[model samples]
Target: MDNSLAELDARVSGCRACPRLVDWREEVARTKRAAFADWTYWGRPVPGFGPPDASLLVIGLAPAAHGGNRTGRMFTGDRSGDVLYAALHEVGLASQPTSLSVDDGLTLYGVRVTSPVHCAPPDNKPTPWERDTCRPWLVTELKLLRPTLRAVVVLGAFGWQAALPAFAEAGWTVPRPRPAFSHGARIALESPTNNPLELFGCFHVSQRNTFTRRLTPEMLRNVLRTAAEAAGLPTRPYAG
Candidate 1:
């Protein structure tokens, strides 16, 4: 498969590879959250929502059941998206700070947001088998993006664990002794065909982290800004 972004997206969104995930996502959509009862949910897998030539890729764990599964976009209609996009906007990567819907006019300048698992998993977790089954999609995405992809920002430990191998499969040299996942953790890898790819780790933007101050707005913004600048993206005009 050529695996162009469009091809990958269409293929990914239609996948029924994991029966457990399929059942859970559709069930949630059918039952519907009380807050989003009237909403028509997106029970299928969600695709990456960003430009095709993005230089920075953001990998999250998976769609929040009612969040992406309902809104048909990564991190949309949720508090986590609230924190993440606000940081992107602060750093000038996003045109707006909020992503309420798929067509809400929020745009990323040079960044792409995706996940290891496309479907919302039961209990916010996907089994190892499910992740492996979905790995090829991510591998294809990295292969297509590597020419311009300078950095990858991992939202949580699951993404950190999931991404390193996919990147290696795409021919990036991950360190032999894997680096631990911590806020601000960074590793520079030599890509076989492109410039070195940098890896960054950050605590997930879950409400628990933000409300408890484990991941503050400033901290998230600083890491994203630093990574974007390192990726050789144009500086935001008038950033004081």
Candidate 2:
């Protein structure tokens, strides 16, 4: 493993910032042991997966119950993740065909995916306190990734909120007037250190969004392509 990945793994394995999340994950692991008996629960914090020098960072809300919680990778083995990885692959960000598990040999090129709350929350919702507790890890990760990070794509409103502080800490003001979360909205800011950070917002690829037609694969692809272009990446032609 790379040094950054090793450090991330250690931090995630030893994370105890939120006792409730720790306990909750343990309970879920124990109760659902028969189902995931052979799986080793990271049970601590979850970290981003991709090259350390990735230019794009995709921030998500939290892990899905059977997705990252089980596969030990954010956005893996779940419906939402399916759409996400498919889009990533379509855009040439992903190396493998799909993201099913850690052992699936999947990799990201210029992008990486992470979440505000590392562990899977109950009912897929995390309390404000839990979000706060996990903020520092996000901060550290951003700092470590600052060298190559040029753009951040927040998957949902919640993710936008969770990522705001990190941008602020990096000295990126919300563009004089705050940048709000609206589908297809884009914002640009300079970090405190004067590093540029471009941001894009999009509705999550949840089942409800898909079933209700609130978010379509075409729309998500467009948003990503726009973000990539803004970040100085080669944009893929829109397939839709």
Candidate 3:
């Protein structure tokens, strides 16, 4: 199999390993949300979005049922994306503050956004078995990105837990017992052939977190900037 990102992404989009997830995503696409009734939903699995040579990677749990699953792009057409892209734009990592669709022309400077699970799961959650089953795709992505990848920002504990093992499989030396996930948590992972990878933890940009103020814009930007710097990528001055 080719190790190219494009090749891996094509394979990701075609995956039908999880029967439940495949059925759920397709069913959601067929039923269509009332708000998006006129739009064609991207019922297939979602792939990572960004340049192939990105230095920093943002890992989330999974695509939202009507968000990425509808727009065919990670984090597109959703409130969570609104919060995330805004912060990324403020910090100069993203070209725009909004990501409404795949053709919106939004771009990431030196950061890539992906999730452990590609398919949208029911209630925005995937079962443990589904997560494990989907792990190989993420591991392959990590391996392809390893050449220039230097830092990772994992959103939420689910992503954090899912990413560590992938990082290890992709060649980073994860510490024993694995580092626990918490907002603002940082850990250094060693690699035999590459520079050490800096890992940072942040709360998921879900509405539940942002609306409740558990994860503020400032907090999100702070983590992003720190990880960007660690990745050796320049960022714009903080707006606030």
Steric overlap count per candidate = 0, 2, 0
Model 2 TM-score is 0.91
CA lDDT, every prediction?
Answer: 0.91, 0.79, 0.94
What RMSD does model 3 have? 0.8
Report the lDDT tens digits of candidate 2 across residue range 19-108: 777777767666664666777665545667877887888999988766777777888878898988888877767776478888898988
**Candidate 1: where are CA atoms >4 Å away?**
237-240
What's the best-to-worst order under TM-score? 3, 1, 2
> Per-residue lDDT for 1-240 in model 3, tens only?
456989988999999999999999999999999999999999999999999999999999999999999999999999999999999999999999999999989989989999999999999889999999999989988888888999999999999999999988888899998889999999999989766899999999999999999999999999999999999999999856
Off by over 4 Å in 3: none
Superposed Cα deviation of residue 186, candidate 3 (Å): 0.3
User: What range of 10 consecutive residues in model 3 has the weakest lDDT sum?
Assistant: 1-10
User: Of the pair 2 and 3, which is ahead by lDDT?
Assistant: 3
Best-performing candidate as measured by TM-score: 3
- lDDT at position 92, candidate 2: 67
lDDT of the structure predicted as candidate 2: 0.79
TM-score of each: 0.96, 0.91, 0.98
